[model samples]
Target chain A: MQGMIWLLGFLIGASPDSVAQQIMWRVYNRPSFQDMHAQITMTLIDPNGTQRVRKMETWSKKDPKTGETKMLIKFMEPADLRGTAFLIYQHKDREDDMWFYLPALRKTKRLAASGKSGAFMGSDFSNYDIGGGEYEDWNYRLLREEDLDGIPCWVIEALPKSPDVEKKSGYSKEIRWVNKENDLVVRTDHYDRSEMLYKRTVVKDAVQIQGIWFERVIEATDLDSGHRTVMEFTDIRVNQGLPDDLFSIRALGR
Target chain B: MAISWLMVLLAYTHLGGYLRFESFVRVDSGYQIHKLATTLQLRTTLDQPGISGFSALNLIMDRRAPDPVIFRPIELYLTFHRGPVDLTLGKKILTWGAGVFVSPSDFVNPWDFSVLYSDLEEFREGIEVADFAYYRGNAFVELAFLPMFRPNTYPLPSLQIPVPAGPDTFVVFMDGTHPVLPEPTLKKGEGFLRVGGTWGPMDFRLLAFRGFDRDPDLQVRYVWLPGSNPQEHPPDTIHLRPEYRPVWMGAGTLTWIVGPWELHADVAYVRTEDTDGTLPTVKNPYVYGAFGFFRSFWNDQWSLGLDLLVKRIFAFGQTPEDPMGVNALLEEQARMLNFQYEETQPSLAFHLQGSDTRDLWRWSASGIYDLRAREGFLLATLSYAWADGVSLQVGGLFSGRKGRSPFSQMGRHLGQVGFLEARWSF
Candidate 1:
């Protein structure tokens, strides 16, 4: 009876783990290209348990086939932080051109990738951190199928090939838990300097738009420091009426 | 020195009549400072006082570097970039300390191409010194020669203390006794030597220095107390015991980085022999100070730093009533009190600012207090730097220390300072 039941399961091809893996690949590697303008708030928790918050407006666009992306970030707050900008054009083959504009200094400094491993907005994120809402910066491979809370999910493992790549990637290998139902990443584990699980992020409150699942609430917690940050999204509009000039340097002056 | 000046003059003469003029004026009306100063400077590098502030007018006609010049090899006279070592020649200065209140290298008396703080004293009293450097990632080393010089002496109105005048109506006093450092890497001239080297994160500096050679020009004044101003009367017996190699001075610094914080400290110690030249001190003087600062970036446009500097200067002293003829001044309340002028300055300093730039759009405010001297100073500067490396900066410094010796005296001061400069590079 057990052998017959196993054969029946194999013939059905409806295993929960296989379903999660399929969903994860379909969701993360969705379309060829997508662009969005977002207001990002990053909160940094130091080893001493002190918290600092910073806000920036960013416009990011990525192309997976050509492995290219462009980012424009502008700071808005605390008066002194206004008028500062960062423009990055990324290419997969080698280095990316990074430019930082200092309002007070009235100058733009070109930064190299070797400096990416440093702090970002006083946060733990390295300048070279691989996220940046892109798919090409990291080589993603479906590692395993796992279940969380009786829900099937797919786990992915990524390894950076070069030292520069590693510096930009805060993880040697990050595991993403994608829900089988909607092809959305539900949770992620970020490692630490010792290659131990140091932090985790949980994404919830998902809403499907244009046949895609997007989460509105993202929470990241530091395991060692007992500190965490909660980021919520609003004005959740996708592909609304955003002018081309809105992303141009000319608009910054006006 | 002669060749460099003549080279600058020849270049200016070739320019003919195309001389540019620029001036910057900064006005601040906040935090109890409501003063104004306008700096107008011109460049020709001519062999004369091309730029001068003739009491009322500030004529600046520098012959070396004027505005709007594209070719600036003059600014890059001697360039040395061998391996990890870099050096520069043709009018450049080296500064060792990071103190905003006081810089020990100010005694070197020269201008530096520093990214910050360029308001320097008269360069005419500055001598030529060799600049050196070495660097290999984490380990770095540097050695420099600081030349001491005497400035041109001018005549001033005589006071009621009866200062004897020379054959003419002027009482000029410019010392030309010894030549300053005649050789590179060797203490060529002078009775003392200043040689030091910095290794790794450590800064070790020792200066064999000398003091006071009977100028007979310092006029005496009454030392004033808070409530009264009085006439200064020197003790009947006095001494001007000139001592050679009378002191050995040194300082140390350690800097390390962790996360976003740069932990740094500046520690200095100076031990000098008990001399009769300065004040009423009866024992050797020693001074030491250590400080640290952390850089905090609020956002891309905003960054702030917090620093705490602890300093102490001690010297043996006689009883309070002992008087000195060294320097005397009138008091504010018109009453005199006899006391030893020797003192120690120990204080805490705090500096907060949004950003630092050569553009007038960027601003900064700074304040400091000297504990033992019971005095304080405040400074503010606004600057602007345009595209193409052209910039303008204007700032002022207010220094006030109370009179301690019976012959020492000073009152509150109200003054203004500003500067307007422009530079172009390829």
Candidate 2:
């Protein structure tokens, strides 16, 4: 059954434990990733009914096999937040180091590693959101077997690492559904403080194009607010040659 | 450090704008240089509060000379983002509230840039504000707190003189004339906590404080009150009185951001309580206040803004919340320094005296108008502030007695004053 397959994956990744390891490589490793850049739009509603809108641009590269990843994100609009970039890399042992280039000082400086959970563009997304987009950062344990949309899946109970793991994470633990046919995760149930499911996500339209399986559509819904974002990945071409300098602060203006 | 200022200058020139630089040096913490090098600042705003406007600058190269330096771990502060929750370290502003009409506290925390408001001398002062956040999603919150351990220096506007014979013994400024609050001290232990967040639309914030401060160099007042007293004030209240003004505050703010217009308001009720009763008011009552702001922007170059504030000190003692006067605690501390003074006690006549007793005070408005929209060719702001009141008693001790009413101390409690600043940075 589906449960059996999910259980197999969970038990396989259960605990590299106690010590530190690049769990991202084991849990959410994807191969042959091309240069990815997203133009993210963020909106904030204040108590006074004031709303602020911001445009964020992000660029990243994944080796797919070696798990080497590098990323750069910056603000595009808003005069106050015009030139800001966050540079991060893949690392083991201690957490990855980060540096921010501020336009005001017009310099790039090191931010303490402890500030990873700090806000990124003042959005709900955190440095953990930058955890190389790995699937294994969550503690996965087989919970049940089920079907999402139509594909059979294995339900796994997974908890995010810890506060040490990410800052401002909305969910403590997540219940995810991994496809039995393919080794990719297809759905997730995000829990709140009381350990109650507050968000549910469904990823569909999967196809192993060019030897790699990928989800085409992802819908994340908040149980309390009923606000949701349906992300659609288009032109997802993997293994496009990207230069190392593509993820540098120098590449910001370009 | 040199490169940072170069960029600002270049940015101002190449970008066709203006900039201002300031570096205030006086000894307060272990004979160290306060604002050593200079403050390369270029402030411009997008949206305005009440008439409130937005601005930013770089607090650059605050270095201490090697000869007799205590510590200068904080070198430079750079900002790249402007949003609800601002993230900063080293030297930056971790601010909260609309900073308009009503705010809980304006103590420039340990974090270099914690309190970034007109009421503050330098947000990049006091305890280094570790980090600050303001979340207004469905849930909202704003908080700023930092390490409270540093060299100790009392707020001595009067004691501007360097200790005649201290270590490495040197005196640059004979008279204290330092800004506000004490320098820094490790014995103070951990700093107080100031946490504020909102749920839905109700604004909320809280503050934990230790030291104190006097009135901001500048404040707002109604130029014309209906009938109270002409000699009294310019029409504002809640003077940042000199006092051991310690407390924890909680409050909330509401804002409406429309395409290019921003209308925001905030209200707070804070309890002024500290670990020690070293301040004038021991059993100080809670204070309430509110603020309103309105701003408009045209494209990315032209804009205008407005801001207003009002606070109320309900009970007795030197109500720190008497937003009309000044920080009483700092005045006593200033005695150690050498500063100018006026000898006269406040009159409780209420009718003639521009000041009130120990109860009820308010701070009217805070703002700056945008003169330049694109590149700062020219910018100007017309602001007026005045505090009208008379102390029927000098916070009680000076109540019945006219001469013994701490007349020397009453040297403070000036009726009211105003200021105007026109800056050309490039």
Candidate 3:
């Protein structure tokens, strides 16, 4: 009876902040997948309703030891941009490394760490959003529980833990609505350095494939410019064993 | 002739090609020039266990006023891949080194100056070669054997300024002779080796090449003949000869990423046969280097690039003295050659490009400044996409120069050209 009482007391004493952190980590981390491949179509839409579309193929793999992820994206459509590629290596606790290849120049260029705040291929989505957010650099707080589009979600506010991260991110804080069912972030509102709402991201469709939940349709809108980017993933394959050589720099030009 | 050959090749291959057509009209100095061009690109691939095969062919038809219907093959290559080794044969275009406006290591393929307004990559003319590439981990080694030497083409004489002749001199033109090109043989072939890899956040390459210069040096021989009055009239018989000399080039390049920008540099040392620089008709050894910075801003909608290049001749002020009474024509020719070989030249180029979020409209401006000559060329264009695979562009080319610089000379002849081009790709 004494041991049971001790266990109940410990459970009751757990702070809400600690519980939110755990839930946020679980929501961002997801199930461990060896590799994934997908064909993604990005459509940029202006406030006037004009749109431009681009297509690309993406391959990603996770390192089991370091929990680092390597991704390769190669453009397929638009003759002018054909053969353009980007390779990214995301570390768990350090800045990500990225390289861009221009086929016309036949050279691969390393990109700066500050590229995380830049747009991804002229789209509304920031490089950080496409590379996966820097989750560990921010402090999360559980604001409330809410229902978004008939799905239960945990509304969490994330603030940069340090000034360096805040400056590098071009964002001061962000509010995310994470789906409780799959621990997938479904919506986010990003606030810029001036503490003004700058952009909003909404995940429209998500499906479970082989026990892994994947975001299928995502839209990012720039609040200031009224520009929107819609990304749709098709032919997605998860948990496929990929060769390490595919992530090498030599493969970028090829 | 090129179309017939392409037809034969296509008849044998199961895979087909894509066709594209483009048209443009330029109005310069009240002169209207119209152009219609067609291109067909063919590609095929085969994949099997431990082996793969791929080939590409590009055929073009360029038609303009007062010129014949020219048919040419831009690229034709066959590639084989096995494991980490890849081999390619036939006519192919390859680009080496890392520079946006200037690349000292891009010596294999010659540029097609006929398409000067197009992108640099589009100006490449393929040459027959055997290329081999080996990849290991993050590093790569490439070797190319070029069996033939192809020189860059220049505009028609009517479109270019002739060698200036003084008012007091009368010139007699002689038949121009072609350069003695290197024979297409194993011994006379050219080759290059490149080894490149990435280290941490930087990428580097070391390269060496043995080849002939793409541009030829003009050797003008003249004889002065006695006129009816020797003091009043000076008449000369002039002969222009083009010569191509051998060169050995060693180059290195490095690329580093700083905050919000990419920094790259390339240096090449060219050792020519004219070591002592005494040959009035041969090019001297020189060192060329370029530094560039590139960055994209405003959510990648705007891109800005700047490149600076320097070329220094090893032996300056070492040309053979001209004989007395060589006439003013010879003096002018020597002066031009001296300007090219004896001086250290520095040039700067910058490009700015911006596009709308939808990418339907784009504006770009680029300029090249020859600091040594104090001359520059500027180009600006605005393009709008009307539909899929179709676009319209309007652009203007201008030059600013005060002296007898290359840009100044060109501006005197061509002035400024305004062009409207419509393109369709399918």
Candidate 4:
């Protein structure tokens, strides 16, 4: 397990800044494979640059006897959000179980996981940036080692350790970077709740497929409404077995 | 030409559609023009592998219709599936409860009050059932049936009665009532049975219907109007015929999620055939209900809903004192069929809606009222999506009444309307 967490942090003498805070909890507990299927494409833009675009199709998984993870998404292209759909489940200790189908009200509803910091289809990526937040609800630290754009990074920072995780993560600190050769997360900034900064993400083309790694483009932006989002990913696939009735809820209104 | 073979199978399937164009202008004084429309809708999908099919079509034209090209066929169903059952068939558009603008366990399809307040899924309409569903992990079990019987399209096709000639004189007819359906016999079809699930943060359903009564029940007919010198001003004409009966419901719905609010409820009970209440053209057993909450703000780009429906009426009799009032003038012309003339009616609604934060401007407002029939309704809209399936909108509709409510006799007979729309989708 990453050499038993670096031999229990080198037999507890642990320092060097807590081994860069155990590499920010091993880059936020990285490890994958249990099912996925993608095909995205987002866009958005605005600040008078006018853009829009959408398209989706997702499917996640991870159950293996309820370790919970589900997912599902749908919306293929913006014909006013065609066929809608969205589901989630996520859970490890609570709060996450959403649904919303709406193919022109063929109903489905059930949302409100406290709007996990909202945005999401109006895009600057929220819903806690598509369900990724939770490593003891944030505390991380590291912040130093540089090089991004020439690879070799590690920045970290995090923070939100409650206030209901800073009010469900409308964030009040974040500043990632990671990827010192593979822990992914290429960039982020966010902050807002008066801590300023307010959104920025970046990640870009990183491939690898079957042996994991992913991240094919992302973008975000919104430094105070100059609005932008990008996303991308495509046909991704991972661990094949899929079908738990494709995240059930009657596969979210077909 | 089945719409030219569905426009030649929409060029090999999977198509979708939309095209609107509206324009109304009534200001009640001066602006005039009232309506001008254009609609077109299409839809297609076919899938295969245990069969699947779907279709939709509409097409309108309206320059105040007297025949301005209409055509409908809103759906055409066909599912088949297998391992866990599924079996649709023909015209569909089912939508059961979770009330949001009313859904007392939605009754099979009928409510195109000629687009009353438009786009509530185009006021529903698509019926010819035979559903059947099954599934079991997240629970489900449906069972439709229906088979003919659709009625509920009104924008008043005639009715202007007012006869009484003499001593203050009057005589104006127009009637055209017509509506006495039911006879395609599969034992006069209509059916329902649902049962739903999802149980952690709740979500439920449970219905049961035995249908027939998408409004209609009023029967009076009188005529005499022979004058010219043979009589001496003898006028009278009042014809109202509608009649369709058979009811029985029992609905239910629940939705819950309590953390940022999202509670819902919907209930029903109906029974009809005057169950105890003197039948002055039947309508008595009742119980309906709705209760709601929904929220989302700022980050969700604002949203809010609030509801309250309620309807009670059970054995509320008394109405045999009309000496010469002629049955209170056929119960005031059947109160324009929104029925439930009292015995606790309640109502209250709200909507809100918002956008803009690059969602490209949008807005909304809604209201309802009707508490003890003091009556109310208001709507407002503003939109602009401008692309990705185009858009542009402007709207208004208002009503407020105390004029002895039946929604103030349908707001003194359908009196407000305002619009400007444009859309496109593909």
Candidate 5:
């Protein structure tokens, strides 16, 4: 439906910037299942090629009643962090709410959601990347049409709408590669506050589960440090009708 | 124990934990092995149809320890959950307050202050409780009953007092022994009720407790010879008997996540037996409060936190002799018995930590300053993670004080020590 609106706007001779935002809106509001459960393996590789592995299980549900997305992630590997869980609630019009639970402490700690620019579990992916950035926080402009590996793509350049947003994001600009066919952002180039290339993320694989597209493999690398993090998703289950109780603090401890 | 028997009978479905080796040397003097220890921790779980059981076992091997080889169970509990109600039984670790380091409302279990800045798990022991909870949406009401009282464990140093009978004063040493445990009766048991919920970016907890103070109250007893001047010939034996007394407490905690900062506050009001400050041996009623905030900077590469704790005693030095004046004898008694330096005591702590972009190498420093006591402690550590399961840390704990305070005594005993630790989790 969002794609149809973008097409209609394009046919009505909308401005290039508005057209770019329309395209981004389609990408942000792409069709997906109601809920999902998956197992993820994250590999961190240093500049010298040394690799460390971590594993986790995640469950995410989009609440239809409130239009909020709730996610729970539990670390399953690297025994020190085993039984550690995080509960996140992403609201539509406000900052997210996060709860972190440690088995050793047997306590749940609530964290401020404004630290979205921080690394996620020491991985190259920031919390903002994991939670998906808000569409209205940036000004989008259509850079140009490009073809990568014989696939048509629209490169959209996004600049923070305000200095506060830029400071919170720790980024000067981000250029995203949106697949023209599926409205999926397959690649992104992140720039530091000085407008230097800081990180690059590319989707290695995308699979369809129950007629819903899912990115199965992603690799994010720090351009400056030569450190890389590769994430692989397995055992993906969609539309499992996950219960609301699974996202509560009680389940976080369990 | 019964839990050991149950552990042997149940089939282990899952197992996890860590092994740690640590060594500390006194750097203030000729190098000496201050502490050398190896610890092994194991946690196992059994998930069945209607109930799930969990147990954690800890084993420590330290040549300097009293027993040398110590083994204990950290947590052994079973849980039953159905719909909105949940029940738990046996020994379990429960954190009831919002404060990170110093929680005025967190008295669910006795703390082991010996490892306050070292081992995270051994800093406190699990309490045996029967817990019941009812939850709906973002709110919960919990009720817990602890059938016995457990006192905090910390190193106790003898205090030297100068007693004056005439124009001269003689020094007398008073030492404290282990605290007397409360009787295991239904009336002597502890109970707690907590109601908490979250609203928007804030959460609050109200707690009511009927229990004994974890910190002991001293009962001073001295043997004095007849016709002996205390100034010239002080008492040969001054025994400090530590006893736990019942107290009524009400506490509340609030946490607000605003912008990039997380703010938390905890306040507790304890009503002791000595409501008035007439008795020098008994501890007077006091209010304990802590406020703190944590914020990250430089895209979360560096984080800083500050916590301030204040304690105020009511009717601090009101005695029959001196109605308005703060009595020196009462102050001395409080210092010797309770380690309280002033009527209104305040301490501030700051923690700062940062890491490299890869997060492979990290450094953190934390310090606490007791303003009234003029005492301070600092701990700084540099750590490296070699692998996902392996890590190494080098740190030092230092204390400084101007006068006779708890930190001063601890500093005198421990000196300045540097430590190296390696850990492997599997």
Candidate 6:
């Protein structure tokens, strides 16, 4: 009995901070859904308040057995950018795979690992942010708990555990405000390499779809550039049981 | 007349169009040449449950040309799609090959070589055809029948060939004579077939065509003697005619993705009617192939592409014991813009493109180096999007050569042209 206690103690000590992990796990692990499909509109706003809107259709599926996620996005607006597609396969323990199809060239090009740090479709979000970085790559600390905008939340600070991970990410550290009610990320502040706040993201219009909480509207603001992007999701369907072939490279061209 | 026709069509169909105007100036060697042109495009589309039709008309006017205005029906096609079968008919531009820079298998539409310095997509000229396509899963088969013959258009004499004064030669000029063109009839139609599909992470296609060579061959009828005295002949005339011959071609293309890179290859084998090379006027059989690689870096902000092409001829003109005769025949063939078969020709080309995250600014550079001809051309452009649909572009064109090659000849005439353009779209 004494040995069991010591082993348990050691294992608990080696793992991430329990308070922060609990909050993050709750936020990341939502209700089970096989697949999702949605029509999204992204509006980019400049410093002068001028806006440019882009429309796209997205489909994503998660493999239950492997715990891998596959996403496919196809552009539907902006005459010059029509018929462009992007496909991504995110693995649990390794690097992700990405492919882009350009209609003008009638060709498909693969993107390298370093591409994750780049912007996503001229938006304020980076590719890494869109793909969701590996949660274990960072060390999490529970900073404090407070009420934000009349909702109780836990503020958490996450720092990259290694220099390599920091280099591959556009952010040196991130602070997230997690809503305790539904375990949703209500707000986040991303710090650059120099530890300066570079961007801020806010989530709104939270609703339950198929017993899973989803943010219907998201806005990201670039602090230095005074530019922002707003994404609104509509015609959303969950647990659609999409076919595996929909995420393959062949579907990119189709 | 075209405006009235467009108005009548718009009453029954959806209407859209754009007007574009551009100016080009060449400043080189104490000479300045300016060309200004305006183009108007009218487009119409009609959609129903299972049928659709689209048409585009182009009207162009040039300030410096003899015929200032011209009208062309760029695309006029109707498509019927039901279940797995799709059929289209009328005049249309069909692109059949997978090559990015050089398409060895795209034989359906003849191109306008006069605008070779412009965007590659602008080089195509639509042709009348009946096309049918069937799809099953990821595989598709397409068949087309071209009912009319359209020949490729080349640049004018002043741009293609330049005459230089020599110590012994007085004056040499090619006579401007209209060549005989093939009669437009159903019996002289062409046929094309392509079967393509994506299977197991690779895309492949097989194509076959039976058509006339768009580029014509040169036939020298006779050389007129000036004043019946070789020494006193101040000017000599070379009577030449352009001839179009039938050809059979088979081609294949494959694109494979390996890790973070995509590799592509295209090859075509052309067999002309002149098999024995007995006729000095016709071109011999040849094979053309190109291999390319493409990759994107820095989050797709930058991309690099490279392609290598080779053209090999199966047979040269009749072999002669005397080397001078071979040289004379080769020179005659060269004047017709035919590939020199005595030496295998290889060329390399590369394109580098980049843009910022917001896509407000873009820059690209491309170059082609001909190994056998020892000549090359480089083109670079930088563009800025001032607004949503307004853009400004600045670019330069440079050519280099070691000897009296075709590109060298072009450089002498169109040396170091610089251009700036502004475009607006709605």
Q: Estimated TM-score per prediction?
A: 0.42, 0.36, 0.85, 0.34, 0.90, 0.79
lDDT of 5 by residue, B11-40 (tens): 546877789999988898886887799989
Q: Candidates sorted by DockQ, descending order?
A: 5, 3, 6, 4, 1, 2
Writing each residue's lDDT as its tens digit, candidate 3 over B1-426 gives 999998865555545344656554545545555456666666553434443434555566767735445445555666676778878888766776667665777666786645556545467766888989998877899998988887765421211223434554444442334555667678988999999988766788999999887766555565557545545544354565555668899999988876677788989998887799676556678888889988877756788889897888877657656433343334344334223533688888788999975567999988778886778777789998775556788887777534233343445445666667676533
**lDDT values, one for every candidate:** 0.43, 0.40, 0.72, 0.76, 0.81, 0.72
TM-score of chain B of each: 0.51, 0.38, 0.80, 0.31, 0.87, 0.83
Q: RMSD of each candidate?
A: 16.9, 21.4, 5.4, 22.1, 4.0, 6.4
Write model 5 residue lDDT over A1-254, tens digit each, in one string: 54465578779988779989889987877787789999999999889999989899999999877768999999997777888999999998888899889887788988887667788888999877887778888999988878867767889999999987787777889999988887878999999889999999999999988876788999999998899999999999989888888889878887
| Chain A TM per prediction | 0.71, 0.68, 0.91, 0.31, 0.94, 0.91
Name the TM-score of candidate 2.
Answer: 0.36
Model 6: share of real contacts kept: 0.29
Estimate, for each residue in A60-159, the C-alpha lDDT of model 3 and write its tens digit: 9999988889999988766556668989888776556788788656567677666466677678887678767666778988787799999888788999
lDDT by residue for model 1 (B32-128), tens: 3222222332222221221211011123343333332233111112435555454434333233343433433223332221112223322221234
Error of 3 at A86 (Å): 1.7
Candidates ranked, most accurate by TM-score first: 5, 3, 6, 1, 2, 4
Native contacts matched by each model: 0.00, 0.00, 0.41, 0.62, 0.65, 0.29
lDDT of 6 at B393: 82
Model 4 lDDT, residue B17, Cα: 80
Model 1 regions more than 4 Å off? A1-254, B1-77, B80-90, B100-127, B132-247, B271-284, B305-311, B319-343, B355-360, B383-426
Q: Which run of 10 residues does model 2 chain B get worst, by summed lDDT?
A: B344-353
**Candidate 3, clashing residue pairs?**
none
Better structure of 3 and 5 per DockQ: 5
How large is the interface RMSD of candidate 6? 4.4
- Tens digits of per-residue lDDT, candidate 2, B27-87, equal 2224333333433444442322212122344444435434432322222332233444444
What CAPRI class is candidate 6? acceptable
